[model samples]
Target: MPIITVTNHVGPTYALEPRAPTAASATLFRNFIQWNVVNAVDGYVVQHIQRNEKYWVQRHFPRHQTYQAVSVDDYWECWRVTVAAGVTTITPARDLINDKFTVVTVMDAPGADGTVGRFPDKTGTRGRWKLRGLVYFVADPGLVIADWPAGGAPSAGLLHSRLLPPIQGNGLARNRQGRLGGVLFRREFAGSWDWTTEDQRIAPRADDGVGAPPLVTYRDPVVSARNFPALAGFRSRNIRTADEAAGGWLPIARRPAHG
Candidate 1:
């Protein structure tokens, strides 16, 4: 198998740098975000969009091992636009834990920053940028992880870099007990937050200010709800606020989060 470096294998919490708005565009450079800042990613909400000249900021720094009993570390990724000055951008979150899942974050430029001198002005210097993505090392993988697999089925955040395993697609590798393996109840970030100008114009200044709250933040793959029993039915601490009767609800999941 030709092992290619894992392309697009990051989840949210790993954001791209700020982008200048432009005209010759589609998603309209609006906003950006990062996700999966800490381990135990299972307790995170996530997906995203664009319209402006904005700088996306994302950081993942953990205090230390606090889960009492669980893995400790972090995971993240970055994104760059394909069409230099395109307007619209939308990336999906397959699930919570980022096992090499390709994450895509989009943005847009509004008002004056988007046309003429705005962007994608084929004839201008501000049209296309080789939007670059660089991974910032956060966790000390060597000290924590004993040994992850070289190849097999893909977990929420496991990446093969270039090694393809026997298992294909997103599901458990084995069938245990009465249901699928201990991985399911997956959720993808199908959420989005959108905004449009009354004049439908890109802002002219760097600080033209018109920021919209993210439609859906953090895009990652998830275990399917259809087979959640495997991951849920077992003994596990519930997210403190998820609001489930101890369980059985999404936002219903609350972390050890406290007031």
Candidate 2:
């Protein structure tokens, strides 16, 4: 998510401070410089990120030898990858966790003489620097309860869900209303239990004006569970460890239909 965010910033700084007489020329030169620089950035930046990561992990895997694995309970927030990687759940888009992601790459330009340049910008070297895949993620600071697994299947459809009641497009859910205070539950009393938990939207004022706001999904989390015909699943960027690729993955077996 952070990688491409850099595209917003690219331009010439002080080329020896633009001279008064050459203002037009300077501006033209700087504009040309900016266009070329950004285009150069985009050419390699766009196409290369997706493939590099797959190649790295699956082909020539790198091991974090010194990296010590920690228990989920002891690990930091970002370090927590859900043990439920394979245990798929069908939660609402917003309910799923691990929402943000980014791609980064390092380009290696090959020189005319077939030599690869180690550094491009600083050396002003002309070599062929190709783009490679770089995967990055952004932890949603707004996630209220995120114990979801890492590399969780990406969310399909409109992955970004909002907590707010429908203000535009679809109307608010029947049970949802102003400033969602909290979800209500019913309590049983007799043979025919009370309908107390029938679902109601209570405002903060309803609880003596001091209860915390009810947490809602600010954005949809990635999900992986469904054979929906019309709708499609999230596009996965598959990567595998070399060891796991020994025999290659087996195809998912299909089941027979029942009447």
Candidate 3:
């Protein structure tokens, strides 16, 4: 679990143009200075991320938060955290909600202290700050539907199942194409699913494009229902969330299997 922490300072607010000779000049200078301040803050953020590329990847999942903003005043401040590494997903939660996302555009550099610095290129803006929370790696398993053996009988050698991506809409499913849209399972033969030798790939795409992967696994015939070595179940990030529900999660059928 990699925790990427970001900080921002909230110092005293002062007009960027300290020595504005006239009201018009002061307003013009303020505008110019405001642009520079924005650039400075934005630049610092970009550089900080670029500097720490070793720890975080270059593609970010962005999360933004505004700290303070005074109505009728030039006091709008906010911070954004961007995850660099490509955490590709079948369907991201933000997408389901029609939220906006920004593709990482900068591989930034850290400031003087090797950490993300606060914004506003102004004096006295030093210590007052906020912490932008951590962005962890997420590989969610929205929902899964598998076929088991009849009552009192262990699953036979062959097993079949369907994997649903995080659900966004009533009928929107993030089904992939060819190899990308599939699932994996670990199978055990000694009456229990063996996680060690689990490399089975279940591709869930058919020529017609409206079918779950017809997965097949082999188990011993002598295996009884009590000692039946079922293929290990999948654990997904989308489980127990509305995303799983959107993925067609069923309480009785698609519930995560307990160890």
Name the top lDDT candidate. Answer: 1
Write down the TM-score for model 2.
Answer: 0.13
Error of 2 at 114 (Å): 46
What's the CA error at residue 72 for candidate 2, in Å? 21
Q: Would you list the C-alpha lDDT of every candidate in the order shown?
A: 0.21, 0.19, 0.19
* lDDT by residue for model 2 (144-205), tens: 22222331212111322222222212322233221112222111110110111213343334
Residue runs of model 2 more than 4 Å from their true location after superposition: 1-101, 105-234, 237-259
lDDT value, candidate 1, whole model: 0.21
lDDT accuracy of residue 67 in candidate 2: 14
Model 1 per-residue lDDT tens digits across residues 71-154: 111211212111124332212333322222222233212221111111111110111111212232111111111122322111
Measured with C-alpha atoms, the lDDT of residue 228 in candidate 1 is: 17
- After the best TM-score superposition of candidate 2, give how far the Cα of residue 226 lies from its true spot, in angstroms: 30
Q: Which ten residues in a row have the lowest lDDT in candidate 1?
A: 42-51
lDDT of 3: 0.19
lDDT of 3 by residue, 159-236 (tens): 111112223221122433101122121111111111112234465555625433334332211111122223422222
